[model samples]
Target: MADRIISGRTHDAYMTVRDHIADGWAASVCTVPKDAPKGEELIKLDTVFEREDVAWKSVERFARAELNNLK
Candidate 1:
């Protein structure tokens, strides 16, 4: 997967994608303040998918929606 960092006016979405032993792929989307430390973030979404493309799509969709909501 590629490195993706989605940013909003004051917040940013950081996505982590990894392989799942039981499932095919796992995706975690976290939102944090633009200038805050790494630990200062919230896990906005956590999902598992059967395909890498689908997992990435879901991550992008959720990240974009969260960023848009901040607008």
Candidate 2:
């Protein structure tokens, strides 16, 4: 199966999405704290963003969860 990651704005939302997906798949969510250091890696919500960029961000988050053993 094609691997994928899905996310949301909050932990509750993230769990909701995770529950909605198929069985046997893992989920990870990225949460950039409000106090995150100012850097290019931090996603800025000051304006709209590229759709693909957001998609990749979620993928990154999911990978992090796996690396951190959240999955």
Candidate 3:
């Protein structure tokens, strides 16, 4: 099946994967404090959900849940 999602740092490789998907996909990242200092051209982990704990797992899960809604 064609990959419909790309979850990782919004770097060159990540952006490339999203660009290749015909149906497009969601991208995500995990970071302490918060995501990238300056937003790029895709999803921002911190913006996906709001919580006191900025754990990687929490942000990851929240991002996945949001992507699942696209299905």
Candidate 4:
């Protein structure tokens, strides 16, 4: 299980968390990569949801503050 999460493969960033929610599970940010994706200085926070507002907002805040370094 550990081998899958940090296998150094490119992922859609927030898709794991979204999938967790969709499958009726609670999820939170565990880690984020610092290396920028190709040409971008910051990876886009491309998270969306129909429900799970609190969890989604928490992730958005965390991504903006911790990952993207945005105020």
Candidate 5:
């Protein structure tokens, strides 16, 4: 299967964990890009197989650490 944008969260320098919580992807692990900074842990989100937009909204509401990760 192709790599999907499971998570789309932004960390403020660092965050403990980032994962997908939709379409059976809630427990899926997030693999950041190779270029991602070491200290910068991105919030990993799993997009629905064919409903990416819907999945995004779920995660965006799940976390509210201050930073608008959706934007």
Candidate 6:
């Protein structure tokens, strides 16, 4: 699957899904600072998931909630 990005005015949420070498799937969520240059800002890993669907849904929900909180 392709990476998903949720952009906000001052921040963006970057969602990445990948296949785990051991087994299952892995998903990660990172917050990007819009003001910083690419690769300059710190990216924090939120969580990992065993299922693709669950990871997608969780990231979407997290992005939405973060956007709402910013408002």
- The lDDT values for all models are 0.86, 0.34, 0.35, 0.40, 0.38, 0.71
Question: What is the per-residue lDDT of model 3 for residues 3-68, given as tens digits with 9 covering 90 to 100?
Answer: 223343332211111222343332344222224332343534423223223333454465555444
**Among all candidates shown, the one with the greatest TM-score:** 1
RMSD of 4: 10.2
Off by over 4 Å in 1: 1-3
List ranges where model 2 is wrong by over 4 Å.
1-50
In terms of lDDT, the best-performing candidate is: 1
Winner of 3 and 4 under TM-score:
4
TM-score of each: 0.88, 0.28, 0.30, 0.33, 0.27, 0.69
Error of 4 at 32 (Å): 4.7
| Cα RMSD (angstroms) for every candidate in the order listed | 1.5, 12.9, 14.6, 10.2, 8.6, 2.3
What lDDT tens digits, residue by residue, belong to model 1 across residues 1-71? 54478889988898878888887898989888887876877889888999888999999899999999987
- How high a TM-score does candidate 6 get? 0.69
Predicted structure 5: lDDT:
0.38
Q: How far is candidate 1 from the true structure (C-alpha RMSD, Å)?
A: 1.5
Q: Write the number of the candidate with greater lDDT, choosing between 2 and 3.
A: 3
Which residue pairs clash in candidate 3? none
Which regions of candidate 6 are displaced past 4 Å? 44-46
Query: In terms of TM-score, how similar is model 5 to the real structure?
Result: 0.27
lDDT ranking of the models: 1, 6, 4, 5, 3, 2
How do the residues 1-71 of candidate 5 rate in per-residue lDDT, one tens digit apiece? 23233333543222222234543333122334444754444445434333444444554444332234444
